[model samples]
Target: MSDAPSAPHLSRRVWIMIGAAAAIVTLSMGIRQAFGLFLAPLALDMGIDRQTFGLVVAIQNLLFGLAQPFVGALADRRGAGTIAVAGALIYALGLVVAGLASNALGLGLGLGVLTGAAMSGAAFVVVLGAVGKVVPAHKRTLAFGLVTAGGSLGQFLIVPLAQGLIDAFDWRVTLFVLAALVALVIPLALGVAGKPPAANHTDGPALKPALAEAFAHPSFWMLNFGFFVCGFQLAFVGFHLPAYLRDGGLSPSVGATALALIGLFNIAGSWLWGAWGSKRSKKGLLALLYALRGLSMIVFILVPLSPASALVFAAVSGFLWLGTLPLTNGLVAQIYGLRHLSALAGIVFLSHQVGAFLGAWLAGLTFDATGSYMLMWIVSIALALTAAVANLPIKEAPLVRSALPAE
Candidate 1:
């Protein structure tokens, strides 16, 4: 052959959609991750104890998780744009309320329920679902990686930015500023709405039958259980690590840096998982990652506490942090197909959030009672190891196609 046919090129519209998705993800996650930087400051400002603050965050995680399925459903039915816009507005309001909060109720309503619900609408599930529709199947993993990495970049960039704001002005001002920033997500989300993509099989089997099929799969249960542990470990550390570092006599800057490091390194970690998932068995990689998380936690606990050590722990642990997200989400797409992925992924995510509730709440309860986080640390490691073992047995395969109606 004299010349091979030239490859087709993606239009400007597709690139614009990709950019919008990335921007939405970055803004949403940046605001969500910035909440950790405010935990202690907000608590102290409101004259509440750490446990009280932890409980609010715990509720947020719970509600966030609980709201996912419903939100995903809405997005699937109404389109992702409407859901994203509503979430952005609610998120903005949540920040505003948190800025003026003077009691636990305000915090709970503003930071917990409102923000949680908003996050449900604006989370990775929705963002990645949109990406799945736009990107080619062969390049989907890379697209997913870019979106996940954008969230990590948000965390990396926003934590320090929020901290700097807090330092330069006040926490209240920082909250208001962040609220203003969150409002920007509304426009970005608009790009994701409209017709479902060719790759997206939105009118597939009924939701009930799909759920039934997933429930019958042994690997699905394994993946669900494994995901629960991921939630437990990550939420526990994310919500409480700042407070724990403070307790250990570290400065607020150290805590912020730790969170930033986790975000920074997680950018690499998520990309690594995306690349690896494209090449290897995702389940096996998941198991190895969980094992590494457990090992990292063990080493962190064993070492004497110090800012240097905390940073080191953050850098190492960060690599294993949200790395689980891309793999877990990819597994859902691979196993269930994209037809009902938002709903199925949302359900699995609910379990993860339940674990998050436990992790965040229990850390506070145990710490309040014993004045030590050592036990929580141990539990996290144990859960990670258990997840590693659990994931080892999961079998990943495509779902059996059914002639059932769309739910």
Candidate 2:
């Protein structure tokens, strides 16, 4: 009742905060997504094979997810702004180190360790956590959707720009340019500089009890597993799709266009999914999304590869891309309440990162050993189907402390 009364008068400050958070996501995600473009170039320059490049990227993905919970918890206690500013500086440093790297070790340290850590603080979980606390409950999902869309927007805008930069200059120079771009996050991050108001203090249990409650719940695990599938599918396709296309004799531009198309379409998808989730059953929609992804991938792989088909797949996949974040994050806040939202969401996101590590690394291994990506595609499809079914039995109601076992 108290939270509902002030819903009508959303202040200018709130909108600014939302915009800043979205912009931060734009830079962070935009730069990261374009890394796939550097795969071939990096391999050639470093005298490494596909698996080595993939492994380092996989390490980055793993580190990104692994760091989220601790970063999120720190954000919860210390304020998202502090975490974000520091993350931005580190992000820029990571890119610079990556640009200067002569071998895989340097890449792993820069891309894997530093940038991954930076993203944990500057990207989705931390940003959305800040947004969820400030926005009203009814409007939170939409705001999250809007923020999520920034990532795709970055992909759409930055990926092509990156491709052009790489084409015009060397990949190393392109990376340096990206580092400069990410440094802008430091200023924008300051716009969302404070913790949630005191009203949020009484909304849910403290961090320890909230962690205990979520860990004990069945629905939480269901969401985690479903998200794992999401991570696997996205990482596999995002990292390997370009190489797969090239293997099929498609032009490099086709791959770049496809990635941009995914980004472009996902902007709309994120918005629609976010709005729809406010009215619909999030778990049901998640089931449908996963099923559609599996169907899309199945069709893409089974059919003859072409620029048109690749572009079509990108558009479809893009729409479904980051929509999961808003719904899944919303569910955490909806069921568990806002207190400790970032930490819980971060934990769920860790499962996603683990899947990403396997997806990127395993796909490389399969491709190198077998000379084709068919096996990995089949595995992705199977996991997607599994996720679709796993999400069905999840309970959507808010958790009651009394319903839990004795502490």
Candidate 3:
């Protein structure tokens, strides 16, 4: 609870910081949300099956996850501004390259490696670290929630826009346009310029100590495992749900609209849970979120397939989509302190991405082998339930008490 402001009012600088961070997250995450929309188009163009394209997206997810710790560590030592700018450029470049790519290696290099690395900078970890440094402790959870919502908003708004563009133009043209959108993050990074809160270096003996503490904690591992479910469920659904719907006789637009719904509802989910985390049990809320995910997926499976059923699924699933983010990030700030927020969060995110890789790749492999995503859906449900259990016994209080300077 360091740097909790006495008053409830937020300063102009804090507002600006939040706005810029959110904008960057919007561009970063918004564009990423559109990736699933391209899967079918790309597959048709390349003459590949779901598993082949799934491997590419899986590579992207894995690379994104793999790059986070290093990016977080860099942001901790350097500043988010530099990282954001680099991320923006690299991200833009990746899109341009992918738009022109003729083969799998080209797609993987452009989308999988470069853009994925860029996202670690432009998305949650970097933005939250920067915004968290400028905000008071009491409002930190709310801030994280609001910023997380920005990404959701981007997802909500961008998916439909991407679909529209795809309808009007080639996917190549759509990608180039998205690249232009990503480049906007560069100037915005200036608004977010600052080193990680000094407490990151001073509050603990050093970054190593904070890292050591987090790695050793059993709750940290639990959080990691639980978040893995989050990644798996999201990646599987995000990348494949549209195709799944296609198999069910739904049109591509149906898939686009469904993804958009998830984004729209998630806007509320992230904010509500974020606000709740400030006053409630973050772990408890996370447990509920995952349990609901399991229940919803089961219901979706049991129900008959139709436009109405799909939309309902989207609405409910979207609300649960990112509900875990704020709670998890808030829990990190609560337990570990904000000094190493990006670094620690990055490690947790890597776990999520690993799940993402497995989710995307496994779904593809299963569909290719069994001609259905039934196994993947079952696994997603099981993991969601397991995530609920994984989070139930977690301790959510601040863990680094020794280093805290006495009042």
Cand. 1 TM to true fold: 0.93
Report model 3's TM-score to 2 decimal places.
0.95
> In candidate 1, which residue ranges exceed 4 Å CA deviation?
1-12, 198-204, 402-407
Give Cα distance to truth, residue 111, candidate 1, Å: 0.3
Candidate 3: worst 10 consecutive residues by lDDT?
1-10
| Tens digits of per-residue lDDT for model 2, 99-126 | 8988889988898889888889889899
In order of appearance, the predictions have TM-scores of 0.93, 0.95, 0.95
lDDT of 3 by residue, 1-407 (tens): 22322324789888888888888888899889899999888877887678888888898899889999889878977889999999999999999999999998888888888888889888888788777777777778888888898898999888999999988998899999999999999999988887665664444446787788898899999999998999999999998999999999999999999999999999888878777777778899899899999999999999999999999999999888987887898888778877778898999999999999999999999999999999999999999999999999998877745544432
lDDT of each: 0.81, 0.88, 0.87
Off by over 4 Å in 2: 1-9, 199-202, 402-407
Candidate 2 lands at a TM-score of 0.95
lDDT per residue (tens digit) for residues 193-213 in model 1: 775654334434666777888
User: Which of candidates 1 and 3 is the stronger one according to lDDT?
Assistant: 3
